[model samples]
Target: MKRTIDFILAAAGLLVLALPVCIIYVLVRWKLGSPAFFRQTRPGLHGKPFELVKFRSMTDEVHKLDSERITPFGQFLRSTSLDEIPQLWNVLKGDMSLIGPRPLLMSYLPLYTPEQMRRHNVRPGISGWAQVNGRCAVSWEEKFRLDIWYVDNQSFWLDVKIFFLTIKKVLIRQNVVGVDVNGIPFTGTSAESSSGK
Candidate 1:
Protein backbone atom coordinates (compact mmCIF):
# COMPACT_ATOMS: atom_id res chain seq x y z
CA MET A 1 0.00 0.00 0.00
CA LYS A 2 2.74 2.45 0.96
CA ARG A 3 4.76 1.61 -2.11
CA THR A 4 1.72 2.11 -4.30
CA ILE A 5 1.10 5.55 -2.85
CA ASP A 6 4.77 6.48 -3.18
CA PHE A 7 4.87 5.44 -6.83
CA ILE A 8 1.68 7.20 -7.86
CA LEU A 9 2.45 10.44 -6.05
CA ALA A 10 6.06 10.58 -7.14
CA ALA A 11 5.11 9.97 -10.76
CA ALA A 12 2.47 12.64 -10.71
CA GLY A 13 4.75 15.06 -8.93
CA LEU A 14 7.55 14.57 -11.42
CA LEU A 15 5.14 15.05 -14.29
CA VAL A 16 3.53 18.17 -12.87
CA LEU A 17 6.84 19.78 -11.95
CA ALA A 18 8.75 18.83 -15.08
CA LEU A 19 9.07 22.33 -16.47
CA PRO A 20 10.05 23.86 -13.17
CA VAL A 21 12.58 21.12 -12.62
CA CYS A 22 14.10 21.82 -16.02
CA ILE A 23 14.37 25.51 -15.27
CA ILE A 24 15.97 24.74 -11.94
CA TYR A 25 18.38 22.39 -13.65
CA VAL A 26 19.48 25.05 -16.13
CA LEU A 27 19.80 27.63 -13.38
CA VAL A 28 21.86 25.28 -11.24
CA ARG A 29 24.15 24.54 -14.14
CA TRP A 30 24.56 28.24 -14.81
CA LYS A 31 25.33 29.01 -11.21
CA LEU A 32 27.16 25.94 -9.96
CA GLY A 33 28.67 24.92 -13.32
CA SER A 34 29.72 21.45 -14.54
CA PRO A 35 27.61 18.99 -12.54
CA ALA A 36 24.21 20.49 -11.80
CA PHE A 37 23.29 17.45 -9.74
CA PHE A 38 24.74 16.15 -6.53
CA ARG A 39 24.88 12.42 -6.18
CA GLN A 40 25.90 10.57 -3.06
CA THR A 41 25.37 7.07 -1.78
CA ARG A 42 23.00 6.84 1.17
CA PRO A 43 21.76 3.95 3.26
CA GLY A 44 18.32 2.81 2.26
CA LEU A 45 16.12 0.04 3.68
CA HIS A 46 17.97 -2.48 5.85
CA GLY A 47 21.10 -0.33 5.41
CA LYS A 48 21.43 -1.02 1.74
CA PRO A 49 23.36 1.48 -0.39
CA PHE A 50 21.62 3.62 -3.00
CA GLU A 51 22.50 6.76 -4.91
CA LEU A 52 20.68 9.75 -3.47
CA VAL A 53 20.50 12.63 -5.93
CA LYS A 54 19.77 16.30 -5.42
CA PHE A 55 20.56 19.55 -7.25
CA ARG A 56 24.12 20.73 -6.74
CA SER A 57 23.85 23.72 -4.40
CA MET A 58 27.51 24.37 -3.71
CA THR A 59 30.71 24.69 -5.67
CA ASP A 60 33.23 21.87 -5.96
CA GLU A 61 35.64 23.28 -3.45
CA VAL A 62 37.20 20.41 -1.60
CA HIS A 63 39.16 22.70 0.67
CA LYS A 64 36.27 25.04 1.48
CA LEU A 65 33.57 24.28 4.03
CA ASP A 66 29.96 24.11 2.88
CA SER A 67 29.38 27.55 4.36
CA GLU A 68 32.10 28.99 2.20
CA ARG A 69 31.29 26.99 -0.88
CA ILE A 70 27.57 27.76 -0.99
CA THR A 71 26.47 30.75 -3.06
CA PRO A 72 23.36 32.96 -2.80
CA PHE A 73 21.63 30.90 -5.47
CA GLY A 74 22.53 27.74 -3.60
CA GLN A 75 21.08 29.15 -0.40
CA PHE A 76 17.88 29.99 -2.28
CA LEU A 77 17.70 26.47 -3.58
CA ARG A 78 18.17 25.05 -0.11
CA SER A 79 15.60 27.37 1.48
CA THR A 80 12.95 26.68 -1.16
CA SER A 81 13.81 22.99 -1.29
CA LEU A 82 14.04 23.13 -5.07
CA ASP A 83 17.27 21.20 -4.63
CA GLU A 84 15.31 18.20 -3.37
CA ILE A 85 13.12 17.83 -6.44
CA PRO A 86 15.40 15.23 -7.98
CA GLN A 87 14.71 12.86 -5.09
CA LEU A 88 11.27 12.35 -6.61
CA TRP A 89 13.02 10.33 -9.29
CA ASN A 90 14.64 8.25 -6.57
CA VAL A 91 11.17 7.52 -5.20
CA LEU A 92 9.92 6.53 -8.65
CA LYS A 93 12.97 4.30 -8.97
CA GLY A 94 12.08 2.45 -5.71
CA ASP A 95 15.17 3.75 -3.96
CA MET A 96 13.06 5.81 -1.56
CA SER A 97 9.51 6.36 -0.33
CA LEU A 98 7.43 9.53 -0.21
CA ILE A 99 7.06 9.21 3.52
CA GLY A 100 9.58 7.45 5.78
CA PRO A 101 12.78 8.14 7.64
CA ARG A 102 14.97 10.67 5.80
CA PRO A 103 18.20 9.00 4.69
CA LEU A 104 21.41 10.43 6.06
CA LEU A 105 25.00 10.10 4.83
CA MET A 106 26.51 6.63 4.61
CA SER A 107 29.20 7.82 7.01
CA TYR A 108 26.52 8.16 9.66
CA LEU A 109 25.63 4.48 9.41
CA PRO A 110 28.47 3.32 11.66
CA LEU A 111 27.59 6.03 14.17
CA TYR A 112 24.05 4.79 14.73
CA THR A 113 23.55 2.67 17.80
CA PRO A 114 21.37 -0.44 17.69
CA GLU A 115 18.23 1.58 18.44
CA GLN A 116 19.09 4.33 15.96
CA MET A 117 19.84 1.69 13.37
CA ARG A 118 16.17 0.70 13.49
CA ARG A 119 15.41 3.78 11.38
CA HIS A 120 16.52 1.80 8.32
CA ASN A 121 13.90 -0.87 9.01
CA VAL A 122 11.77 0.97 6.43
CA ARG A 123 12.78 2.70 3.19
CA PRO A 124 14.23 6.21 3.31
CA GLY A 125 12.00 9.16 2.33
CA ILE A 126 12.03 12.61 0.74
CA SER A 127 10.28 13.86 3.86
CA GLY A 128 9.28 12.38 7.20
CA TRP A 129 8.26 13.02 10.83
CA ALA A 130 11.63 14.46 11.73
CA GLN A 131 11.48 16.89 8.81
CA VAL A 132 8.09 18.32 9.69
CA ASN A 133 8.76 18.30 13.41
CA GLY A 134 11.82 20.60 13.64
CA ARG A 135 14.37 19.58 11.01
CA CYS A 136 17.77 21.20 11.64
CA ALA A 137 16.44 23.07 14.68
CA VAL A 138 16.09 19.85 16.65
CA SER A 139 18.89 17.85 18.16
CA TRP A 140 20.14 14.72 16.42
CA GLU A 141 18.79 12.65 19.31
CA GLU A 142 15.38 14.26 18.91
CA LYS A 143 15.43 13.71 15.17
CA PHE A 144 16.30 10.02 15.66
CA ARG A 145 13.57 9.74 18.27
CA LEU A 146 11.05 11.17 15.83
CA ASP A 147 12.35 8.91 13.08
CA ILE A 148 11.99 5.83 15.31
CA TRP A 149 8.55 6.95 16.49
CA TYR A 150 7.39 7.21 12.89
CA VAL A 151 8.92 3.81 12.17
CA ASP A 152 6.80 2.27 14.92
CA ASN A 153 3.60 4.28 14.41
CA GLN A 154 3.47 4.78 10.64
CA SER A 155 0.02 4.38 9.15
CA PHE A 156 -1.72 5.59 6.03
CA TRP A 157 -3.44 8.38 7.91
CA LEU A 158 -0.25 9.29 9.76
CA ASP A 159 1.58 9.50 6.45
CA VAL A 160 -1.15 11.72 5.06
CA LYS A 161 -0.84 14.03 8.05
CA ILE A 162 2.91 14.15 7.70
CA PHE A 163 2.59 14.81 3.99
CA PHE A 164 0.52 17.92 4.60
CA LEU A 165 2.73 19.02 7.47
CA THR A 166 5.75 18.74 5.20
CA ILE A 167 4.09 21.09 2.74
CA LYS A 168 3.52 23.57 5.52
CA LYS A 169 7.12 23.34 6.67
CA VAL A 170 8.40 23.91 3.16
CA LEU A 171 6.13 26.90 2.63
CA ILE A 172 7.25 28.49 5.86
CA ARG A 173 10.87 27.51 5.23
CA GLN A 174 11.00 26.33 8.82
CA ASN A 175 14.41 25.40 10.16
CA VAL A 176 16.01 26.08 6.77
CA VAL A 177 18.69 28.36 8.13
CA GLY A 178 22.17 26.85 8.29
CA VAL A 179 20.90 23.79 6.44
CA ASP A 180 23.80 23.76 3.96
CA VAL A 181 25.28 21.19 6.35
CA ASN A 182 23.81 18.75 8.83
CA GLY A 183 23.15 20.57 12.09
CA ILE A 184 24.86 18.72 14.94
CA PRO A 185 27.45 16.01 14.89
CA PHE A 186 26.02 12.75 16.17
CA THR A 187 28.74 11.03 18.14
CA GLY A 188 26.64 7.97 18.85
CA THR A 189 27.12 7.45 22.61
CA SER A 190 27.90 11.07 23.37
CA ALA A 191 24.62 12.20 21.77
CA GLU A 192 22.71 9.59 23.79
CA SER A 193 24.17 10.83 27.07
CA SER A 194 23.79 14.52 26.12
CA SER A 195 20.12 14.03 25.29
CA GLY A 196 19.64 12.04 28.50
CA LYS A 197 18.12 9.22 26.49
Candidate 2:
Protein backbone atom coordinates (compact mmCIF):
# COMPACT_ATOMS: atom_id res chain seq x y z
CA MET A 1 0.00 0.00 0.00
CA LYS A 2 2.77 2.43 0.89
CA ARG A 3 4.66 1.42 -2.20
CA THR A 4 1.57 2.10 -4.28
CA ILE A 5 1.24 5.53 -2.76
CA ASP A 6 4.91 6.24 -3.32
CA PHE A 7 4.74 5.30 -6.99
CA ILE A 8 1.54 7.19 -7.69
CA LEU A 9 2.68 10.34 -5.96
CA ALA A 10 6.18 10.16 -7.41
CA ALA A 11 4.95 9.72 -10.95
CA ALA A 12 2.51 12.57 -10.52
CA GLY A 13 5.18 14.77 -8.99
CA LEU A 14 7.61 14.06 -11.81
CA LEU A 15 4.99 14.91 -14.38
CA VAL A 16 3.93 18.11 -12.65
CA LEU A 17 7.50 19.24 -12.07
CA ALA A 18 8.89 18.20 -15.43
CA LEU A 19 9.17 21.65 -16.92
CA PRO A 20 10.77 23.13 -13.88
CA VAL A 21 13.16 20.23 -13.66
CA CYS A 22 14.18 20.75 -17.25
CA ILE A 23 14.73 24.44 -16.62
CA ILE A 24 16.86 23.62 -13.62
CA TYR A 25 18.89 21.21 -15.68
CA VAL A 26 19.58 23.85 -18.29
CA LEU A 27 20.50 26.39 -15.68
CA VAL A 28 22.80 23.91 -13.98
CA ARG A 29 24.49 23.14 -17.26
CA TRP A 30 25.02 26.82 -17.99
CA LYS A 31 26.36 27.48 -14.53
CA LEU A 32 28.13 24.23 -13.68
CA GLY A 33 28.84 22.93 -17.20
CA SER A 34 28.25 19.47 -18.68
CA PRO A 35 26.97 16.47 -16.79
CA ALA A 36 24.43 18.59 -14.98
CA PHE A 37 23.30 15.69 -12.91
CA PHE A 38 25.26 14.26 -10.01
CA ARG A 39 25.16 10.52 -9.54
CA GLN A 40 26.54 8.61 -6.58
CA THR A 41 26.01 5.28 -4.95
CA ARG A 42 23.99 5.34 -1.77
CA PRO A 43 22.59 2.67 0.50
CA GLY A 44 18.94 2.03 -0.11
CA LEU A 45 16.42 -0.28 1.58
CA HIS A 46 18.15 -3.09 3.50
CA GLY A 47 21.43 -1.23 2.96
CA LYS A 48 21.57 -2.22 -0.66
CA PRO A 49 23.41 0.13 -2.98
CA PHE A 50 21.64 2.25 -5.58
CA GLU A 51 22.64 5.22 -7.67
CA LEU A 52 21.20 8.35 -6.12
CA VAL A 53 20.80 11.22 -8.56
CA LYS A 54 20.67 14.95 -8.05
CA PHE A 55 21.53 18.10 -9.95
CA ARG A 56 25.23 18.76 -10.06
CA SER A 57 25.59 21.78 -7.85
CA MET A 58 29.36 21.68 -7.46
CA THR A 59 32.13 22.08 -9.96
CA ASP A 60 34.58 19.37 -10.92
CA GLU A 61 37.53 21.53 -10.00
CA VAL A 62 40.08 19.33 -8.28
CA HIS A 63 42.46 20.33 -5.47
CA LYS A 64 40.05 23.01 -4.34
CA LEU A 65 38.12 23.34 -1.10
CA ASP A 66 34.49 22.25 -1.03
CA SER A 67 33.45 25.85 -0.54
CA GLU A 68 35.47 26.85 -3.56
CA ARG A 69 34.08 24.03 -5.70
CA ILE A 70 30.52 25.05 -4.83
CA THR A 71 29.40 27.89 -7.05
CA PRO A 72 26.77 30.50 -6.15
CA PHE A 73 24.23 28.77 -8.38
CA GLY A 74 25.09 25.51 -6.72
CA GLN A 75 24.47 27.09 -3.36
CA PHE A 76 21.08 28.24 -4.54
CA LEU A 77 20.16 24.74 -5.70
CA ARG A 78 21.19 23.29 -2.38
CA SER A 79 19.38 25.99 -0.41
CA THR A 80 16.14 25.57 -2.34
CA SER A 81 16.62 21.82 -2.61
CA LEU A 82 16.12 21.98 -6.37
CA ASP A 83 19.02 19.61 -6.66
CA GLU A 84 16.90 16.81 -5.17
CA ILE A 85 14.17 16.93 -7.81
CA PRO A 86 15.82 14.16 -9.79
CA GLN A 87 15.24 11.72 -6.94
CA LEU A 88 11.57 11.57 -7.81
CA TRP A 89 12.73 9.30 -10.59
CA ASN A 90 14.48 7.17 -8.00
CA VAL A 91 11.19 6.93 -6.15
CA LEU A 92 9.41 6.00 -9.37
CA LYS A 93 12.04 3.38 -10.08
CA GLY A 94 11.27 1.72 -6.71
CA ASP A 95 14.67 2.59 -5.29
CA MET A 96 13.17 4.97 -2.79
CA SER A 97 9.98 5.97 -0.99
CA LEU A 98 8.18 9.30 -1.08
CA ILE A 99 8.82 9.52 2.62
CA GLY A 100 11.47 7.65 4.51
CA PRO A 101 14.89 8.22 6.05
CA ARG A 102 17.15 10.09 3.65
CA PRO A 103 19.81 7.79 2.22
CA LEU A 104 23.37 8.41 3.32
CA LEU A 105 26.61 7.71 1.45
CA MET A 106 27.38 4.03 0.89
CA SER A 107 30.71 4.59 2.59
CA TYR A 108 28.86 5.20 5.83
CA LEU A 109 27.24 1.79 5.79
CA PRO A 110 29.85 0.10 7.90
CA LEU A 111 29.92 3.02 10.31
CA TYR A 112 26.32 2.50 11.37
CA THR A 113 25.61 0.58 14.54
CA PRO A 114 23.18 -2.32 14.58
CA GLU A 115 20.38 -0.03 15.78
CA GLN A 116 21.29 2.70 13.32
CA MET A 117 21.33 0.16 10.55
CA ARG A 118 17.63 -0.35 11.17
CA ARG A 119 16.97 2.88 9.32
CA HIS A 120 17.47 0.95 6.08
CA ASN A 121 14.44 -1.22 6.88
CA VAL A 122 12.42 1.10 4.63
CA ARG A 123 13.21 2.71 1.32
CA PRO A 124 15.25 5.90 1.56
CA GLY A 125 13.63 9.25 0.72
CA ILE A 126 14.53 12.67 -0.64
CA SER A 127 13.10 14.29 2.47
CA GLY A 128 12.42 12.83 5.87
CA TRP A 129 11.80 13.37 9.58
CA ALA A 130 15.40 14.43 10.11
CA GLN A 131 15.18 16.72 7.11
CA VAL A 132 12.06 18.55 8.27
CA ASN A 133 13.29 18.79 11.83
CA GLY A 134 16.84 20.17 11.36
CA ARG A 135 18.40 18.68 8.26
CA CYS A 136 22.12 19.30 8.15
CA ALA A 137 21.87 21.73 11.02
CA VAL A 138 21.52 19.00 13.63
CA SER A 139 24.24 16.84 15.04
CA TRP A 140 24.64 13.39 13.53
CA GLU A 141 23.42 11.91 16.80
CA GLU A 142 20.23 13.95 16.77
CA LYS A 143 19.55 13.20 13.15
CA PHE A 144 19.96 9.47 13.74
CA ARG A 145 17.60 9.70 16.69
CA LEU A 146 14.93 11.33 14.55
CA ASP A 147 15.53 8.80 11.78
CA ILE A 148 15.11 5.90 14.19
CA TRP A 149 11.99 7.46 15.66
CA TYR A 150 10.46 7.65 12.21
CA VAL A 151 11.54 4.10 11.53
CA ASP A 152 9.58 2.92 14.56
CA ASN A 153 6.53 5.14 13.98
CA GLN A 154 6.20 5.45 10.20
CA SER A 155 2.68 5.17 8.75
CA PHE A 156 0.66 6.63 5.90
CA TRP A 157 -0.53 9.50 8.04
CA LEU A 158 2.93 10.16 9.37
CA ASP A 159 4.29 10.27 5.84
CA VAL A 160 1.59 12.76 4.92
CA LYS A 161 2.53 14.94 7.86
CA ILE A 162 6.21 14.82 6.90
CA PHE A 163 5.39 15.65 3.31
CA PHE A 164 3.73 18.90 4.28
CA LEU A 165 6.35 19.76 6.85
CA THR A 166 9.03 19.28 4.23
CA ILE A 167 7.26 21.74 1.96
CA LYS A 168 7.04 24.27 4.76
CA LYS A 169 10.68 23.86 5.63
CA VAL A 170 11.79 24.18 2.04
CA LEU A 171 9.62 27.23 1.41
CA ILE A 172 10.90 28.89 4.52
CA ARG A 173 14.46 27.83 3.58
CA GLN A 174 15.13 27.07 7.21
CA ASN A 175 18.13 25.04 8.33
CA VAL A 176 19.43 24.74 4.80
CA VAL A 177 23.21 24.52 4.72
CA GLY A 178 23.37 25.50 8.36
CA VAL A 179 26.13 22.99 9.08
CA ASP A 180 29.56 22.79 7.56
CA VAL A 181 29.45 20.62 4.46
CA ASN A 182 32.90 19.23 5.14
CA GLY A 183 32.38 18.39 8.77
CA ILE A 184 33.82 15.26 10.29
CA PRO A 185 32.23 12.04 9.15
CA PHE A 186 30.12 9.83 11.38
CA THR A 187 31.56 6.89 13.28
CA GLY A 188 29.54 3.95 14.59
CA THR A 189 30.04 4.85 18.24
CA SER A 190 29.70 8.60 17.79
CA ALA A 191 25.93 8.60 18.18
CA GLU A 192 25.51 5.38 20.14
CA SER A 193 25.64 7.02 23.54
CA SER A 194 22.76 9.36 22.80
CA SER A 195 20.54 6.51 21.64
CA GLY A 196 21.68 4.28 24.52
CA LYS A 197 22.54 1.55 22.09
What is candidate 1's lDDT per residue for 70-175, written digit by digit as tens?
Answer: 9999988988888999999999999999888888878888888788899999999888888888777677777888999999999999999988888887798764
Against the reference, the lDDT scores of all candidates come to 0.85, 0.83
What TM-score, computed on C-alpha atoms, does each candidate reach? 0.92, 0.92
| Winning model by lDDT | 1
Candidate no. 1 TM-score: 0.92
Clashing pairs in 1: none
- Highest TM-score: give the candidate number: 1
Q: Give the C-alpha lDDT of model 1.
A: 0.85
